[model samples]
Target: MDRKRVNACIEEIVKARKADGGLKQVFWVAAGGSNGGFFPAQYFMDRESKSLRSQSFTSNEFFLAPPSSLGKNSLVILCSMRGTAETCDAASLAKERGATTIALYIEESKLTEVCDYSFAYESISYDETEASEMNASYGLFLAMVLLKKLENYEHFDLAIESFSVLDRVYRDAWNYTLPLAKKWAERNKNESVIWVLAGGPAYGAGYIFSICNLEEMQWISSPTVNTCEFVHGPFECTDKNLPMFILISEGRTRPADERVLAFLKKHTDQNIYVLDAKELGLSRIDKRVSEYFNHLLFSPILNNVYLRALAIAKNHDYHYRRYMWQEKY
Candidate 1:
């Protein structure tokens, strides 16, 4: 994951911040799954950084109306897999605004050229389940490293050490989750619609599966419901005719997820497939930072097992696209 390169960039940011005393704001900009990838970093900065302000924006929106506070002391991070044109332009705009820009991409492209520094997450060049190299993991790591360097986070040492064991823990999680993922896919593969529910860090994984995996890849009508927002309006569709893919994350907002889960089980007859984070046994991660990593733990299950099985069962290849590259928007 190029931890050394990430460390160098954060050091450089620290140096720049010290020179001007203006490293208070961070903006995460990207599109689609790449935008989802930076959610953890924004959430982390919101929860942990006492002096830092963070925001996440879809690339086009960022280009259209950037925050007025986005200059000098700000850090703009643009993430993408192929470095889509919109995101690359966003990187250029960020650079032009005098913000220190970083591009977190799976590969180097024109977007990387526009940034002050580029770090590869290596999502494509990885095998099986690259625990420390997932999209969200890299963002979280960068946040951790930045906070650790900037403010001397007490548990950062243990959290950094935990990465050494994450791959092994990830393998165990994959093995444990595979059977249930396959079971859920086999039982509900023919369902016409699905409500994918998640909360906290795992929300991005649910977002990816619903938008990128189910709707875009398998041509299924899948809408994502945040567990925190489920009771507001989405819970109205609580009948036996509907199916739900519920994710119970292990993090700050887990109680919200649990509350919605309890309500769903009691009031609805819908076929519910729950992927509880507790069952994944992520004890190998340091307790101080474990909760922040629920997204990484849930990713392999969603990507390789649940989503893949459903695509196979529905006779659709995940790579198939109707109009993504074939038609203009």
Candidate 2:
């Protein structure tokens, strides 16, 4: 684990936050990589508090909610790996509109100047989790700490306990996923894209996991399809050669997994990578409690690990900041 880098990043966020007043009354905004996991971490703070909210936007894009309750009482804590135009534009807008801007990015580029305070993790290096992966994990944990300090949640102890379980789940899951990742690397066979399917709590996870375009190791496009949408339209076109990867996490959305698997079976010709939760063999089920949080938190952790392993399997350097050149929006 890059604890030194992680600790430094956490300390930077805390220090920058202190300089900008404090995080107790701020909106932690994140898009792109951490959008899946860290966003939920921010959202963990009860919505009624008027102190926290996570802004989620379209793929390859970042959005600013119309200046509502956020202008006066809130500051913007934006996270981006590459510091692309989408993130830069959003941060610029937030800063312009009187929001104290704080950025958690991998490289200190344009965003560093635009933001009032910037915490760039210069130590994480290229062949690791980079931006999204690290940001997601850190974002959630940081959000929890901030919320506990500010918000008056009675179940704080339980929440923290549950949160601690997430790391073990990811580590356990990686054990099983490593072999699958290797298989995906050895047998990709020039496949251009990988379709990831999920809905409910895993819906957001599916979206982020599917859209890992920032990593340059594999030109593999990951598009998340609505479980129902696949049955209606994309299912007909998919064949054995064109495979899709489905994320099956256990929860209320378990039924969606069955439907997705059934559909895949019907289209047996297409290559299918089923990233099931059981296969991951996570150590604790407590981490699996929140469909929303787990998908965002755990999935990215798994992704960062896989991204590193995949890069190694293919002998390529892995860095999100370097891949920023190709991001158009």
For residues 137-185, write the lDDT of model 1, one tens digit per residue: 7888888888888778777888778776777877887788777777887
The CA lDDT of each predicted structure is 0.82, 0.58
Off by over 4 Å in 1: 124-126
Q: Which pairs of residues have clashing backbones in candidate 2?
A: 36-296, 37-296, 37-297, 210-222, 239-270, 240-269, 240-270
Clashing pairs in 1: none
Estimate, for each residue in 1-329, the C-alpha lDDT of model 2 and write its tens digit: 24345445445555566665654355555555545544455445443245545454432343544446444335566777767666777777777666667677777777788987666543223333323245654555555555555555455465556545655565555565667677765665355666777765556667666665322345567667877566778777677877676777666666877887887787693578776665554324444334434564446544565555556665556553444566553
How do all models score by TM-score? Answer: 0.95, 0.69
**What's the lDDT for candidate 1?**
0.82
